[model samples]
Target: MEEMKRVLKETVDRLFQEMNGRFVRLNEIDEKFGFLLDLKGLIYDEKDYDLKKKCNELGQFYVSDIDGNELDE
Candidate 1:
């Protein structure tokens, strides 16, 4: 169980980093923030995995092109 958790955590961490990088690159394009990358609120369920159990949230990523002050048009 411990080993599974550790591996899961590592996988989640790597996924978050990759997602963040992709979001950043997309944001760099001057094409008016077409879509928002909001993976920070992702919910993971262990039941969905091979192990029919429950695990806590492993990681999160939140990278966006638009700012809070920006208006949606």
Candidate 2:
């Protein structure tokens, strides 16, 4: 009976550790996705002419369409 109790405890502890690791990774991914969505919305609000000029000056490339695709200038 004592050995059985020890085995059960070890199993539960391993399962809890695995779950904690997954939860932490998921939180990190959610934060990154939220930041990208905000940035895309801000860029969409600007006028096309202004965006183009800014891109040229900054030497960075960006898609003017609704899609948020960026390329290296």
Candidate 3:
């Protein structure tokens, strides 16, 4: 029982470490693609958009794709 518990603990620890490593890489990818790049507000910055869909819209890149590319008119 003690050995089984030790093995389980080790396995859990390894899994957690692996998850942490993946998260670090995920952060890098997010930065590369501007995903969650700015956590200050709920939305992204205005400059990221190509056009302003609404007059009251705050951000420029309000309408964009997965890669942050603005939509064409």
Off by over 4 Å in 1: 31-73
* Between candidates 1 and 2, the lDDT winner: 2
Candidate 1, residues 21-56, lDDT tens digits: the string is 998887764223222222232224234342111111
Q: Using TM-score as the measure, what is the rank order of every candidate, best first?
A: 3, 2, 1
In angstroms, the error of model 1 at 51 is 54
lDDT per residue (tens digit) for residues 19-67 in model 3: 9999999886664444333443325445654233332232333334322
Count backbone overlaps in model 3. 3
Q: Show the lowest summed lDDT stretch of 10 residues, model 3.
A: 64-73
lDDT of 2: 0.55
Task: Kindly indicate the candidate among 1 and 3 with the higher TM-score.
Answer: 3
After TM-score superposition, the amount by which residue 71's alpha carbon in candidate 2 deviates from its true location, in angstroms, is 10
Runs in model 2 lying further than 4 Å from the true structure: 35-73
TM-score per prediction, in order, is: 0.41, 0.47, 0.49
